[model samples]
Target: MRYDVVVIGSGFGGSVAALRLAEKGYSVLVLEAGRRFADHELPRTSWRVRRFLWAPALGCYGIQRITLLRPAGRRGAGGSRAGGTGRGKTRAGQSGGRAGVLVLSGAGVGGGSLVYANTLYEPPADFYADPQWAGITDWRAELAPYYARAKQMLGVVDYPRTTAADKVMRAVADRMGAGDTFRSTPVAVYLGRPGERVADPHFGGAGPDRAGCTHCGSCLTGCRVGAKNSLPKNYLWFAERAGARIRPLTTVVGLRPGPGGAGYLVDVRRTGAWAGGRQTIAADQVVLAAGALGTQRLLHTARATGALPAISARIGALTRTNSEAILGASVPRRAARRRRLDFTDGVAITSSFHPEPGTHVEPVRYGPGSNLMGLLQSALVPGGPCRVRRWLAALAGRPRDTVRLLSVRDWSRRTVVALVMQSVDNSLTTYHRRGRLVAGHGHGRSNPSWIPAGHRVVRLLADEIGGIPGGAVTEPFDVPMTAHILGGAVIGATRADGVVDAYHRVFGCPGLHVLDGAAVPANLGVNPSLTIVALAERAVAHWPVKGAPDRRPPAS
Candidate 1:
């Protein structure tokens, strides 16, 4: 089937494109490689592997996807599939480029929105001043209107009330002598009456009704209460009503110039289906929004096979991790029980603080009964023995405190996760060697795994709450972990410098666009979703309708 456009990966970028084009009377088809889930259909806890993990070969199809991005050196030995999920899986290798980076991204119709804590933030001025694309335009000024419009469209608002986690963050900031920097986080949610259904709150009667946030703290596990402002509830929903077709569980594997000047031919296959179910569809334009990893993987394979000969050699340049690190602290169960502070009482992330210039720290949570932290976090310092042996020995030495911090069932209520990011200038390169996408240190120094300012904030957070400190498992290996992955296939001045132009149109690939994190030229110190949406709004605003001149965007 042919359409005006075919968008791969309905994430922040693709959702914006789908809604805007469909609203403009264009034929749009959004091909999502994951399943479409209704609010009621989402998993209630992260412990349900069959409903929480994204492993197709093991027959466990769910939202959260964890990919082990091995360094380029360890390639040959670990390049084998996990039974049959297609891409060669590498045994988690030692710290290296993207430095021992482990990618935890969302896989579903709404992309990362299916799993992201709804905290929304705009990057600091440093993000705009990066030399890579600073000369392109007055970016901060140029993107201002688009950013405001995106916030409105996303239903962003300040979290209405405070929670135990909020107080802890406030205390942490005070101790840092940065109390002025602490504030309730701005999030995409309906902060109306908890669980009460209300008419369309964002769009004027054009979007779906919503339920107020229940402070269930399950936002990360897919907001079963229907209050979180996920894409399907807004952008994608409006696009569908305006005639956009959403085909889920369909992965695009190949792209080339189409026959009879149809513009482009997109080769696709059913995701997780048996082999040989491929099909081709034509479109006048194709937008790649399959996120940082997904889009880069697809483009690398295409260019290597001569399917996209004009692709720039800089396709993998300047990829970023937002200079992020995940560290945390947990209160002892006895103390938590006495103090009656439930870390899991409010939304996933309710408050944040900046300990020093360019450093941001936010407290994150998961509702009761969700203990996936047991899988992602380890003791802040890895030492004498395995984590199990360490925990067992510690339990024998300090039973109450050890059991309080280590209990799987109570981890959520007793723990506070510190999401740290900085505006430091650093990046990495991605390669599609040996049929797998791997990262290597690029440009400046490798991304920082230890930020003194960030760790100081987490430590203070733990001390204030009277808890034990822990960090990302990969941290001890001199690597960072993050959910906010950006860059690769970035915008540049010319075909020789970058893969795309300032407006997100590929340099040599006509009618091809990349509007996701992959196109961001530099590291954004905050969550990148709002930036991706604003960039898409700016890019698509330049697209002229079929057989007509481009119309001016309405004033905000």
Candidate 2:
């Protein structure tokens, strides 16, 4: 089949591209590797790992995909896959004294929104003003209207409920003298009455039906109540209404210039099906929106195999992780007054406070009975011999008694997880090695400090919440993990500096573009979903009207 534009990934970028391009009278096709999930199909909790995680090989249909990458050299190796349920069992070469970096990301039709905490944040001006941002255009000013459009489409609103965690965050801010900065986080969730289905308030009923947030705090597990404003609920919904064709469970494997030498040829295969059934499709334009990891892997493989040798050498450099950390404290119900701390009373993140410079922390929660994540939580002890000290401090006096307190059921209800992120400019690069991708801190710098200012805020939250400090899966393994992975195929002043231009067009490959996190030049110090959407809007705004006389070139 041939399309006017083929978008390879139905994420924030691809969804926006599809809607806008179709609105311009072009036929658009979105190929997503993950199955299309209805609200009822989403798992209520993470306990059913198979249904709550995205490992097609293992038959896990969930939205989260966790991988451990062992660095091949001094640079630390790690990569994260956050879009759809397609699985690859490829492995890397074994090495010594290497710490494995934990990568956490989302999958499925809505992309990261299927598992994201729904935080719709705009980074401070400093991010755009950074020297690494090589742009002739004033991006901040240019993206303002687009950002507003994205927020409206995603149903951005302040979290609806004030929970126990909210009060604790407020207290933490007051005590730290940054009280003014403490406020409820704006999220992409419907805030109408709980359990009530409502007309599309944002789109005047033109969009899909939505349910009000139930305050279950299971936004990460997948918003089964349909309260979360994932891509499918907005952009993709409108795209379909506009006649765009969305093919879920279809994975793009390779791309080359079309036989006539003007468009492109894309090879695809059914995600869960066996081999030898690849199908090739033709397209006048191809927008690479498979996200940071997916796009990078595709381009890297294509370049290596001589599929697109014009791809820049800077393909896998400067992948940003928002300098983030997921650390929190778990309070025992017995220690709380009347055991009244219900951790699941609001959206995934309710309130946030800045504990120190370059640090931002938000109180995160999960719904009751969705306590499977408690397994990754361990007592937090900073510095040397963390593992041994953590166990010793957690037990304190009686090991047997403390063990019961660590039970998943009680731990989740009593815990307030802090989703800590930073604006500090630290990054790693991803490389294709031995048929697989590996991430590592680029040479000439020590490993990026994964737990810096964030740890201090974690400690403070533990004290205020009346809980023991806890660590995420990465901290125990002595590595780093981040949900907002940005960059890799970043934009730059010229082709020599980056793979894509400021308009998101591939430098040497006209009629081809990358419009996802892969093109992000730097970390936005916030959830990157909104930024990606706005950028896609900007990219599509420049798209020529279908069947128009040749005006601007397809790519600069």
Candidate 3:
């Protein structure tokens, strides 16, 4: 049987497409490569690695997925491979890449929503004014209504309460003379009484019932508290009610034109299986929402293998990770235990402030039961000219701090991990080399490797919060980290510039669309989930209903 539309991943973009298209009376099938979870089935903490991490090769089928990327496509820097386009050579002004850039993503029925902090931020003017696709439309104006729609659908609101973490963040902002910039984060969570289950407050009872947020600070581990508004609870839920079906563990490997223009034949298989579970299915139209990594990987390999040769050469030319850094400020374990300072008393990221121009910072946390991420931190060590001297000096200054961070089992509960993002653009060109993603720094600013402002902010934050300021273990070298990876199959006016058109339609592939983060053309400088949803809302608003051409949500 041929589906009217088959969405390749059930994240923000795919979920919105599934709902809107299904509401239009089209048969929609969402194929997700990860498993689904009932709220009860979701892990309560990161310590349950077998249930929280998604390393299927190791028999773990969970939501969190970590990908380590290196430059020049070199494999063995103890890195997990990032998918790339085809083999290629770089011209002058680019050479051996940075040490490592670790990307964190999610794998589940709801995609990255399963693991993201519930922060929802609208991109600033610079994002809407970006030169890449600025000429196409007045984006801020165009996306305004859709952003409102997205906020409503996702149950977005100003964080209802301030916790200890928020107070610290506010203090930090005030001390830095940026008090006006400090505000409780906009979040997607039910703000009902703790643990109180109520009928759907969104969609006029058409969506799922929700329980109030418990302030468990476990949003990143998966919201077992029924508070965080992951997509499965809203968009996918309504899509299913509208007769859309979802198939989990069904990964699409390739796509080829169907015989006589019937559409496309999508090669399918069980995701992460070492053996055979391959087959093919037919679809009249396809929407690729498998994310920046997954979608670009498929398109690149398809183009390389000649399965989808018309795919543009720019498929993997531009990938952005918000030019982010993961830094930490944690009181020592002994002091933390004495004060009983639980950083996990609020939502994952409750407060944010801009400490410097072009940079956004949000304090993040995890609950007591989850501390695995502590493995990534170490005392801050300045690096640049005096490498050996700096290391020894850092050890002398913060020697006990490193030991405390490493030895603390309740590190997650004691620390706030501040995510710092810069509008200063930097990028990676990801392509397939020797069956793996070969990534190299693309043309852009080089400061992503070392955001001096971000380091200063973290150090100051530590001082204010009564702790030692350190950073991700990879920060000393090439390990910049980001949870918001975006833009590979980006928008362009023609096939020569990008793989997808402004409407998200593939430039050369008819009836094909990329409606996920991968299709985003500009750096958003904030949590990108809301923008992705809003963009998808606009993308499907242009789709024809089953029997007519009249607009559904009315064209933007």
Candidate 4:
């Protein structure tokens, strides 16, 4: 079948592109690799633990596991596919191997928006002024209108400061003497009048009506309360209404220029255990919105096969992990207050503090079923060969005991989970190897500005609130983790310096464009979902449709 636009991947970038293009009267088809999930389909209790974590054999969640290998000398090894046909399939059909480094990301309809903490902040001014961004377009002016559009679409709002957790965090910030940096995080949620819901209120009755946020702490576990404003509830939902067909559990495997036309042919597979099949889609325009890892892998494979050799060499360069860390502490409550009620009940990240330059700290809350508290307890136990060893031992021995102890203790009353981040510019690159995206390892210089700032905030928390010091953790490392990953296929002035031009069009390919985080030139020092949405809006706006065109002919 043919579409005016074929969008691969349905995360922030893909979602926005699909919606905007469809709104412009284009016949759009969105191919997503993961299955569509409703709130009920998501696990709300411990009984459904398997659904929360990814495992190929057990009907994995959308998060893909990645490995970071040391760069292969000057000349890297030729990339190849590991197993059957390079097609996505049920767990039984997937290749059996482990990645050297494991990076987690969401798949399915909403993409990372499903699992990400909805924190939205603007990029620093210096980000737009950088030489890397100057050549593509005047990012500052181009992005302004779109950012406003994205904000209105996502229902971005600030915390009410009414929750007890918010007050405590503010008090802690004040005691630290760096209280001036404390502010309500701008989140994508509604805070309007009671019982009255309106969709697309900002667009004059064109969007969906999102019920206001109830402040449920279960945003991570899937907001069953209809409060947390996720993309599925807004943009993607509206896009479907506007006539875009969202094909979930459909993974695109290959892309080749359309037979004698200004378009391309896309190969896709329906993934599942019951039954699966393959199909081809033809499109006049293709927008690659798959996140950094997914898009890099797809583009690399396409380029390597002579499908599009004109693809710039800088395709997988400037990758950044947003320079984030998860630092948290536990506050033990008196035995009398332990069993009263669930303090975590209506709290969805209520406060934040920046104790020093370049550092950001915020309260992290977990639902009843989240094992985060147990993880924190394990990290706190003293004594072991090393921090890793100690953490392993704690994980094995103390998780249950600590949970039982905390179940009776009022930790939520006195404790606030904090995440500390520095605006350090360290980054890594990603490339395709054996049909998969792999990150190259090696730490760039750690920015001292973030470290000192982080330490200052940590010290204040420990001293003022009498909270215990904790360490950082990510997917492979037992430290904290972040959902924001940016860069890779960056935008540049010329094909030699970057993959796409200022307009987000491929350096050489005319009808091909990349309109997602992959186009971001630098880390925004904040969650990137909102920025991606805005950028996508700007991209589609630049390419206004001139009525619908005829479908491209089939391949010979």
lDDT by candidate, in order shown? 0.80, 0.76, 0.81, 0.63
Record all residue pairs in model 2 with backbone atoms less than 3 Å apart, i.e. clashing: 52-62, 53-62, 71-77, 76-440, 77-439, 78-439, 84-107, 84-108
Candidate 4 C-alpha lDDT tens digits along 195-282: 3455645457665555565665656656555556677877898889989999887777888899985699998886653545878899
lDDT value, residue 3 of candidate 4: 93
lDDT of 4 at 168: 58
What TM-score does prediction 4 earn? 0.80
Off by over 4 Å in 4: 45-47, 54-56, 62-104, 192-209, 273-276, 332-347, 372-415, 441-452, 462-467, 473-480, 547-556
TM-score of each: 0.90, 0.90, 0.92, 0.80
**Model 1, residue 466: C-alpha shift (Å):** 1.5
Model 4: ten consecutive residues of lowest lDDT: 81-90
Model 3 misplaced stretches (Cα beyond 4 Å) = 73-99, 383-398, 549-556
Q: State in Å the error of residue 429, model 2.
A: 0.8
What lDDT does candidate 4 reach at residue 319?
62
Which candidate number maximizes TM-score?
3
For lDDT, candidate 2 versus 4, the one ahead is 2
Instruction: Quote the positional error of residue 241 for candidate 1 in Å.
Output: 1.4
- Give the poorly placed runs of model 1, Cα more than 4 Å off: 74-98, 260-262, 382-406, 550-556
- Runs with alpha carbons beyond 4 Å of true place in candidate 2: 74-100, 333-338, 383-406, 443-449, 549-556
